[model samples]
Structures are given as structure tokens and as C-alpha cells.
Target: MNARPGSFGRFVADADAAGNLVVQPRMGFCAPHHMRTGLALTKAAAATTAGTLTIDSYTRVGDLAAARTALGEGAPLNGYPIAAHPAACTRALLDGVVDDTFPVQVRHGSSHPEPIIRALSAAGLDATEGGPVSYCLPYGRTPLDVSVDNWSRGCELLASLMPDGRIAHVESFGGCMLGQMCPPALLVALSLLEGLYFTQHGIRSVSLSYAQQTDTAQDEEAVRALRRLAAEFLPPDVDWHVVLYTYMGVYPASEAGARELLSASARLAVRAEAQRLIVKTAAEAHRIPTIEENVRALQTAARAASTARPAAIAPGGSKGTGDEYTQARTLIEATLELSPDTGRALRAAFARGHLDVPYCLHPDNAGRSRSFIDSTGRLRWSATGAMPVPPAPTSAGRTSVSARELLDAVHYVARRYDAAPAD
Candidate 1:
């Protein structure tokens, strides 16, 4: 199936050119009417915004029958069931809302996204996000090799849409793996690798993601590293951008804290020159946010971004090369040298402990990597496993992070934010 040309990539590029931070909500609904309403509201929001149709879990795991039964029973779903819903239904839902100014991306956490891609393409949508490693490691027990193949197939399917005028844009979720506490270097490395994988499969436009970490300066360095790496590695023709995911870790219980944290993310995006921001609402600590809540969050982020200083002079214009950039470059270059085929290289990287995600317990992951929040709030590696990156400067010759320490590190952001003064 071929998609019509509604360029989500172009829209974001336009926003970046205008120095506007494109804020997007992780919003979804099971019912078509509600979903349509959400998109409409998002498009009408008082900010430069994009739309999202996050796929439901049942459809993500390929359980279409269960999704259908829930639909028939009028049961609410955590997200939109894109695969189970008719293509025509999705088309209708997207019809009036998604356009040049407000492009929509289907956010589905599926290792095997062929069906989802096919359905969205048929419905005239041309953007989505996920990665072979990102979608596989955290979501389920799918083997890394199988997940790699599935994403390869999915990218090929998206590429097939190009002959008819659509250039599908895919965003890499690799940077947000395990949501928090992973060092910025590995996050940046994974995102660049996945973007390369997408390009290797013929995707012409892509976005590399990075989640906001503990320190603002550290996060800025990571985003700069991402842009620098993308420039050095990705093909010249690939239209690419950086996307910042608002702190994906534990949310603050207080509304003020959540809003403050969200505003902080918006500022980070501006300072770091990210083209888009995936926002989290004040209700993040409680439950799924309503349309009003999402809109409020978008507005808040936009306001915050407007007050921020734009990214420094040029891409990678920051001072000396930081450890994050050095480590990420080493990881990416090492992986690329492993095999001409990116998928095989990724599989081999994990197998050889060259690629390891901290706190990720997937069967394929090398569990030796460990990280902790340093005293300065920067995420520092406690252990680097067999990865070629250098040892953490703060390791103090200690080789491991205790379980209780790990628990505290996981909730560090939430606790700090919650205890902060009201805005």
C-alpha cells in the first residue's frame, strides 16, 4: 500500500527552521470518535504541535482477535488498535485533522510492525516510530535476532510506499530504552545505530530520539553528540532531525512538579536544538491524561520553549568533545565495522557484549552494564560490561551498584521534582 504525501518530516523541519519547538503528546483512544476528537484538539492546540495515534497493547502483540473482542464489548483500550481497526475507519479519523501543519505519526511499540505499517499506509499516514532493539528489549521476550528481522521487514514495507510519492518517516525509540538511568552515551549510540538501520533499509527520512536525563548540561551534550554523529554517519540525502522525549522515568506525584519537569524538558529541547518534544502531562503520575490535560501540557511546553535560547551556533558547536560523544562514536563505529548488514551487526554487538543496556533484563542483553546517578545528578556508569567505552570517572574502583541503590536511582528524578518548590 502506498501513502499520500503528507510529510511529517517536512512539517518538523519547517518548525525547526522557524525556531519553534514542535511539541507532541503521547495521546490515543480506542474509539474512533474519541480518537478523531483527540487529533482535532491536538491540531487546534495553541502551539506548534504534531499528532499521535499510539497503538494499543493488544494490537502491538499481534492479538487482533482480543482487540476486536474488546471493541465489540465497548471496553476501553490503553491506545488506538490500529491493526484491528479498519483502514477506512482510520482514514476517516485522520481525514480532517492531519495535514501539512499538523502531521500525525503512528506510535506503536511493536517489534513486528509490518501489519501496522500496511494499515497506516493504506490510511494515508506516512510516519511512525520504533526500533529493532528499542521495541524488542523492553516490551517482551522476543528474540533480538527475530526483532531485528521484523523491523527490517517493517522498514522495507514503509520503503515500498515511496514509489507512489510518500516518504515515510520513522523515529528511533532507542534513546529512551528502559526510560531512565541509562547513561546518555549508550542512549545516543543506540539511537544513531537504529537511525542507520532505518536508512540502510531505504527509509529516506528519520529522527533520532534522546530522553531528558538528570542534568541539563549533560542532556545538552548528548543531543549535540546525536546531531554530530548523525551528520558524520547518515547519508546526505536522508532528511533527519533530533527529537527530545520529556523525562520518561518515574513521574512526580505533584502536579506542580510534573509541570515543572515538563517545562524543563521544553527548555532542554530549545537549548539542545531538538526539532520536536514528546511531552508528558501533569497526570502522568496518576493515569492516562484527558485531551484537555494533553493540550495544557503542550501549551506549557510551547511557552517554556519560547523563553529558551535557541541551540548554540552550529551543530556540535559546543566546546571540547565530551565523554558522551566519544563513547557514542566508539560504540557506533565499532558496531558498523562488525558487519555491512546493520541488523546482523546489532545482534552480534549484543552477543559480544559490545552493546549493553543498563538495568535491561532482556535475555539478549549483556547484564554486566550498570549505572548510577552521581552526586551531581549526572548518570554515570558504575560498570561498562564489555563495551569499548571507557570506565566511569566516578566509579571509585567500585564495580557494582547495590539493588537498593538501583531502586533509589530509578526514582531519583521523581523524588527531586516532587520535593521542588511550586512554580
Candidate 2:
């Protein structure tokens, strides 16, 4: 989308096509408890502040019936209206679960928009000129493999689908940890490259979806680093939105507790001047969140934003941001200059299990038992067949899994090849 300068309020106003404002709610980071409770809070906030609330319903990860239940139960309590996407709304439409259905504009895969647009038109929900509908794309971090060839194909696909420019806003899918691995320089380059493409096209609004981490000491540092990187990469010229989620991966015990944690995190984000804040519920660690959880989390985030104030600028201001950008640039330059060395080092690290690259969520190691040691020295896995799925902890705690364990697993699997008498 074309990047433009606008306030959150302005963006909301511009996004509406039904002559009414709608707030799109999503929660994919926190535990389910937080999401359920948060939806209740969001409805209350919208009622008190905005004209009226129309929920953009879709589960980031959950069951639909339970979500509908939470919405039905909570909407009345908060005195606001709710809406569901086509998928969930389809069932609700048939069973009379909701008042109306809002279809989500989706690109089938990687920027190809034609099929989706055609489908929307065929379904008679084409609000291209000024529809109340909004588009959602399941965009993860630009995959490591997003080469020029892929980019060209993606651009061509989008161009074909959106010839008339009917889409109002685009919401990217799935939370990612960009700052954890991508250096600031790389972020700037990538942003510049992608930003140019998006701006060249007619796309107007975009939101960054980031997986949330707890505000522990280590996490706080990570957040600070990430914030600095964002400052460097996020152009002030374009309208920007940020979605922060709580770590449901670790804390999935209670929804209420998760909400509390998310609220605290939202407060932190507000201080940082994040345009939009989303709090994920705690239930996501084990299962997909029901619609109720999604609504609850959105509700809680809305409430939190209502009372939040901007925080004072940190000591470094944009200095840290600039430095990270410079460092990233240097790294990229070095990599280009020493591709052979860099590749060898990267492969070596991968082989040793010292570095866990993105997309390689699982890896195997040989000859050594595996265990993850937490900050408190607790080991979670050993001799991996399938790692134990620990119960979601109530408090933020750490557990370490050793690289050796992965190596052992790799070795065990490789033995079959080794024993196969020379092929």
C-alpha cells in the first residue's frame, strides 16, 4: 500500500467503507485467557469512545463456537455490536449466530490477488469502490528465500489481482520476531526495498505483526533493541501500525492473568508510540483460540490503549536506532563481500546446532543427549524422540534445550544410512 502520513484516528476513518467505523481485532501472541478477557475489555472501550464497534472476526488460532459464545456473552456486557468474517460468519449465518457477515479479502498465496478478488466478486461481497470489507494477507517475515525471482512473480500476481485498486487496507498474517535475528541494516535495506515496491503500488495501509515476548530482563533488552531497529527502518512518512502479542507459548495458565500481563505490555508499547497495540491471550500455547478469546484480547487492548499515555523518550533517542542501522549495513556489506566465508560459517553453525535459523524450527544433532537448561538450571528435554510438552507455566520461566540433544537425534537417524552397507 502507498505509505502516507496519518493518525490512528484518521486511518480508522479512512478504512471504513460502510459509512461507519470498524475496528479489526486480532490476538495471536498471548495465552487464551488473556484473549477472552481482552475481548470483553475491547468492547467496553469501543462503546465508551468510538461511535460503534463492528468486530472483524477471525481466530488467529482457535475454535469458532467458543469464540461465538464469548462474543455473545461479552457483547451484551459491553453494549457494543460484533461482526464475523465469512468463514466463521458462514456457520453463524446459517445458525443465526450473528447479525451480519463481513468477508475478509485474502490473497491465496504470496501476493497473487486475482483468484481472491474474483472469489469475492462472485460471492457478491465486492465492496471494491467503497466496501466495508478489509483485506487480510497471511504474510510472514519475508522468507529468507524471497529472491528477485520470487519478488517479481509476487509483484506480477498482485498487479493482476488489484488492477482497479479496490482493497482498503491490508493486514499481514502471523507474528514474527524480526529483531531477534535480522540486524538493523538488513531491516533498513529490506524495508527500503519492499517499501519501494509497496509504495510503487497503490497499497495504502499496512500493519506489522510481531510475536510478543514477556517483559523479563532479557526480553526487555530484546524489545529495546527491536524498538531501536524499528525506528531505523520504519519510515516516519508512511502510516504505520504495530501489533504486539503476549507469549502464549510460555504462559497459558489463566486468561485473566494473561490479560494483566498483556495490559502491562501495552502500556509499554504506548510509551513507545506504537500506533496500534494488540494483546494476545494466554490460551494459545496448547490449542487454537476460540472466537471469544480473539474478541476478549482485542477488547482488552482497546481498553488499555484508552488510558495509556505516551512515554518519555529513552536516553539514546534515535542514536541506538542509527547505530543498529549502520551495523546492519556493515554486516550486509560484509556478507556480500565474503559470501563464501559467510556461507561456510552459517552452514557450520547450523551443523553444530549453535545457530537456529528461521524456518528450521526443528533440527537433529548426533552423539550427545539433548536438554534445555532454563535460567534456573532446569533441563526440559533429554534424548529426544519427541520433546515433552510441558504444561504452560503460570509465571515467566526459562528452560534450556541443549544442542547436544539435537546432535544425538541427528546421529541416531544417520545410523540407518551408515549401517546400510555402502550404497
Candidate 3:
């Protein structure tokens, strides 16, 4: 597909017109310093000549406005863009503060589609019917059975709501599993299957969001594995992207450290020919990142990508780490196989039309859970515990919650309370 006219182009042109080197993609404008850096990077990387590269920037809602300002004022494009947040928390983002946001939407057996739909409306973004902005549907740490059913139902609901095709992308989150590793084959197959499912359901883009250890050679190998999967499974017609979000709390605490990690990540991405790169801010694992901190982090990552030397693609190793590559391949393969079973369960749950009320470990469950369910139906409270069950079926028949609603419920539960024993 032809590239869409992105905010970056306008930023570049604006910078050039204004005689500034800096160009911010968010506002489609540029300044002089930005231009010089771009030129310098272009010239410096001429030897490696990987061809034209594109980078999109992403951040959280609290940082969106500032990120937009930095981008418009001229933040570098060596990284990919993707703002991450729990599905229910991004109402502010869709309110139009950031360019985009990816909210996790976990599916239990039930559906709660209103928040997403309402958020889209509140943001003045259209639905699939009205050219809605791209939103992420994240399957959080829900059990495989619930996750698949939730995702499938979510897709069906989205398709139904967006006959005109509003969704632009769909992504999944990786959680700690079996040593926090998914088998390689499973990863590959799931990637393709997800792409197919989204494509079939009318979503035009698909991506995966997972955290990685920046300190290990294994991380680099995992990137290579992803590249191979992209090459083999990604349909030529599909707009596919992969995001290797760093676990900021793990390594690279200082500016210099962050730069080194970013440089390494950029090289890996370039070698892999990844469509986009998402460089996590240093504050990620520790706490929520402030806007200024995030911008600084992106700046550091951009510099690394722009200035780093392209490492030779080792015969089989990435950065001389053979084990990394081997492990990555193995893990991805294993994960891909499990995806179908996961998908099947998710589809079945959606078919059953049960609501997955979210319960979390956090203290904010009251506001969060209420936001997910509709105004008319009350949350069915279990006599034994705090777990809120779905209200009884209404006169219109058992009131069915959308997939989005189920996810919201899951998010609420996960954030505020531990999962209750499954009924």
C-alpha cells in the first residue's frame, strides 16, 4: 500500500520553509537545527546505506501534549511511535492530547464495548464507519482461554461498529509466562494469525507489544527472529509493524546508558528492517514517566539510532551472542502454536456473550469498574467477595456487553484486585 501522508512530512516541510534544521513530525513543522541533524545522520549513514528509514514516536497520555510539542519543535525520528496505557485509562488520550495511544483491552467471557466507542466519540475520532483513529486492542494477562474469546469478540464488535473500516491496527501484550518466554514458533504463527484475523475483520494494521531485557544479547536475537517472522509471515498487502519496548527499569539508568541501549536497538531494528521502533523511556519500569523525561529519552534514542555504526549481521549471532538468537527463535515458535488455541477460546467466549468484570489489586477499582459497565445495569456483586458479577439479563434479552467492555472489566480487576478464583 502507498504510504499515507504522515504528520512527519509536514513537519519536515515546515522546518525547511522556516529555514530551521529542526522538524517536528507531530505538528508537521520543522526548525533549522533539526534539518542539520537529519542531514548529518543521512551523510554519516551513507556507508551503510540501508535506504530511506522512517521512525514514529510514542508515549503515554500524561506526556502526549509535551511529546507533541517536542515532535513539532523537532524530536528525532530514530525511534517508533506508540503510546502505551491500560485500555481504560486512555480516555484522556483519545480526548486528542496525543497523536495516538494503545490501550490494553482484555476479554473475559463478557463484552463491554462502550468505553472504547465513547472514547472514540469523545475524541471526535470516528468509528470504523467514520474513519476513526487507530486504537490498540491489547490482550493483557488474561488466561489464554479468556484472552482469545475476548479478542475475537472484540474484533467482531469492532467490525460490526465499523462497517466503513475504522480500525487501523491491533496489538497484543506479552506477560510473564513459563519463565516469561513464549516459544518461537508460536510467536511467528500467532503474528501471522493475528494479522490475518485483523485483516479479515477489517483492521488494516497489526502490531505486537512486548517488553524485553535491554541488557542481554538475547534481546538482540529476539529482534532478528521477529524480522525473520515478518519476512516469512507478513503479507505484502498488510501494514505490519513490530515494537520492541525496552524494560526501562532494567538497564540504562543514565543518559549515556540510555543512548547506548537506543543505539543498539536502532541497529537491531535497521538490520531486521523493522517497520517501526518503540524506544521505551528510562522511567518505564520504575514508575510512570514524566513528559519531559520521555522526550529526553526519545531524544537520546534518536541520537543513538542516527549515530551508531551498523553492526555486521553475524552469520547466526547478533552482537556475537548466538544463544540469544537461538532462544528467541525457539520462544517465538512455541508461542505461535499456542495462539490458535488461545484464539479459539476467545471466540467461543464471545459467542457465549458473558461479561468479564475487571477486578484489580489497585485501590481505584470503584471508579475504574464503574466506567466499564453501562449506566443502566448494575454490577452483580458476589455474596462471598468483592468480585462484581454481571447484572441479570434485561427485558431486551440477556444484555450483552461488547468485547471492549469485557476488557475494561479485566483492566479494572487486574489493576485493583487479584483475579478471583474462576467460577
Candidate 4:
């Protein structure tokens, strides 16, 4: 994989340079043929696309023993176990489908990602997504320090592989903390922090991520904030882009409802000036989406991107994005001042309450931070806790999160889309 511009990161960069929105599916399958077919469908879908090999849970948790057991027993694991799959099979899945036009990224939520990274590297892949804090705090009990060390090695391996045109692209999952409910400022701060970490560890190309949040306007501001911060802090040599995830919260139970929400996410991506999108399917609310469902989502989002208008981005230090830009930067500066090393600073930041996530149950998390939906449906920090949230208009009508309020906030998108008059 001596990519001189052949890497997935470059592929998306070219699309963005052409002002195209690159859409992708969160697709994975246990079978080689199924995974290959998914990539083929994603590549052939009527959209600017990329391929994804989202690894299964067992592999994600580093339970390769169980992954092997499941594979041997033919248990229906949700995703392809790249770390355990025969390298030939995994490589075969992408042989022709993963060319210059159709680059692929391996997505796995692993705190211990070395084996996964090694396997992907062996299969000639250089692009993937995850981060120390983002993948650890929200998903599991993995120690933050341990995850940082593992990712440090993982990033070095990827960066070391930058021979030829193979640029290592690492997308930070930080911005989508808890998928929803966390304030955009914290999300942006974390994502930027992760990008900086990647750069520090040697990844040259990184995609700062922001999930589509509650209010469309708020999300636009969040993306704007993300882009601005990346431009300001990220080194130019570390080529960076932005990727938006569809609403990662509770999905609408109805197909019509789910499609509506998916379209909304695509529009969110385009309007926010994001270059890439991670799409979810109508079957998301029910079960794992089939490849056809994923392809349909890709098409729907591509169509949405085509018709979407550009978002109005307010200038920095202003309330254009509800002061999220200012607040997120504040967090980053505070964290960087912790220590010279990115990993140590991240660990110290979490330990010292300089960085916090709302509603996250991990032990390393400072569970004090709390967020709630405002009357306008924008996610607002009800209690900024230790992280600083500069005064912003979005915080004016912040509702207190009771059990009922929390439930409604979680279902915000689903209810709105499901209640829409069906087509």
C-alpha cells in the first residue's frame, strides 16, 4: 500500500477539494462475502463514497479468544473480526473495491487497538478512527492512561507507514461523546484535542469529527467552531478534515421516520461545510442495518448533500455558534497548559476537571458535568461543572434534566422525525 495519494484520506481530500460530500456507511459483516458485498455496494452507490470495515465487539474489546471462538462456532457476530480474520480474507474483501476512487477506513471502538491496528496495517490499510478519551470514556472501563499509551504506539505505527503516497488518516470520535446530550463545546474541544494528539504522535492527516447535534443551527455553529479551532491550532503539515456522524442517539422506530432523520444529518453535514459524513440507516432503530439499507442511506444522504445550502457561520468569539467556539478553545488551552506531552496532558486534564463529559459513566470521567436541551432544542450546559462554558444565549432556557427530561431529550430526534406527517 505505497499510496502516494492513494490512501483513503487523500481520496476524501480530493472529493472535498472538488466540493463534494463523501458519505459512508457504518457497515460490517461476519462473513467475507457479505463484507466484500457491502464494500462493493458502498462503492457502487449513487454517491461519493468510501468503504468501512467496522470490527465486531469482541475484537474491539480485545477478546480475540472469544472472537475466534465465535468464528469457529459460527456465532452471528455483528461485524468482521479483522484482527482474527485471515489476512488473505480481509485483504480479499477490498482487493479491487478499495482503489484510488474508493478508499476504505477500518472503524473499531477499541481502547486496546494495537492488534486491530496491526491487523489493518498487515492488510495494507492506513486509515481508521478512534481516540484515547473518546473511545475509552464513553464505551468502556478502559483506563485512560493505558489507552493513551496504546494509541501512542498505534499512531506511531500508522505514521511510520507513510511511505509512498500512503497518508495515515485518523478520525477522532471525540466530538461525538455520548453520541448526544454532551454540549457541542466539550465535543469540539475533545475532538480538536484528539487531532492534536494524533499530530503529536505522527499522524499527518486527521479528520476532526462532530456528530450532528440537536438544533440544526447549533450543529452548524459546532462544525464551524471545529473547523476554526483546527485551523488555528493544528499544524498545516498535519493535514486535517472534518467528518460528521448522523444522529447517534435513539433512532426513530419507523422507516419513514429514520430516513427523514438520516436526510437531516446529511443536510447538517453539507450546511456545516463538513467534507465527509457517516450515515445511519432506517433499520438502525430496529436492528443492525443490512447492506441494502446502508446503501439506501448512502443514496439518501448523497441526495441531501446535493440539495443542501451552505450554513451561515458566525465569526469567532461571538455567539454565532452560541459561544461554543470560545468555550471549546478555552478547554483546549487549559489542557495543553497541563504538560508538554499530549497524552500526559489529556490524562491530567481529566484528572483535574479541566475536561469533562456529561452523562458518561466511566470512572475516569468527572460525572459532574451535566447538559440539557433548551427550549429551542439546542443542547446546553445546565451545569458547566469544572469545564468552563462562557456565557452564551443558548444557556438561557436550559431545562433541568429530570428522569423525564432526560428521556425526552434522548428521544428528541426520533420523536420529531417520527411525528412528521408521513410522505
What lDDT would each prediction earn against the true structure? 0.90, 0.35, 0.35, 0.86
Q: Pick the candidate with the highest lDDT.
A: 1
- lDDT for position 200 in model 3: 57
Give the clash count for model 1: 0
For every candidate in turn, the CA RMSD to the true structure comes to 2.6, 14.4, 17.0, 2.7
TM for every model, in the order presented, reads 0.96, 0.47, 0.46, 0.95
lDDT string for model 1 (240-272, tens) is 889999999999999999999999999999988
- Deviation in Å, model 4, residue 92 alpha carbon: 1.7
Tens digits of per-residue lDDT for model 2, 358-382: 2123232222223333334222232
Per-candidate clashes, comma-separated: 0, 45, 73, 3
Model 4, residue 380: distance off in Å is 0.6
lDDT score for candidate 2 against the true structure: 0.35
The model with the greater TM-score, 1 or 3, is 1
For candidate 3, give the lDDT. Answer: 0.35
How well does candidate 4 score on lDDT at residue 420?
A: 91
Residue 187, model 4: lDDT of 91
What is the lDDT for 246 in model 4? 93
TM-score of 2: 0.47
List the candidates ranked by lDDT, beginning with the highest.
Answer: 1, 4, 3, 2
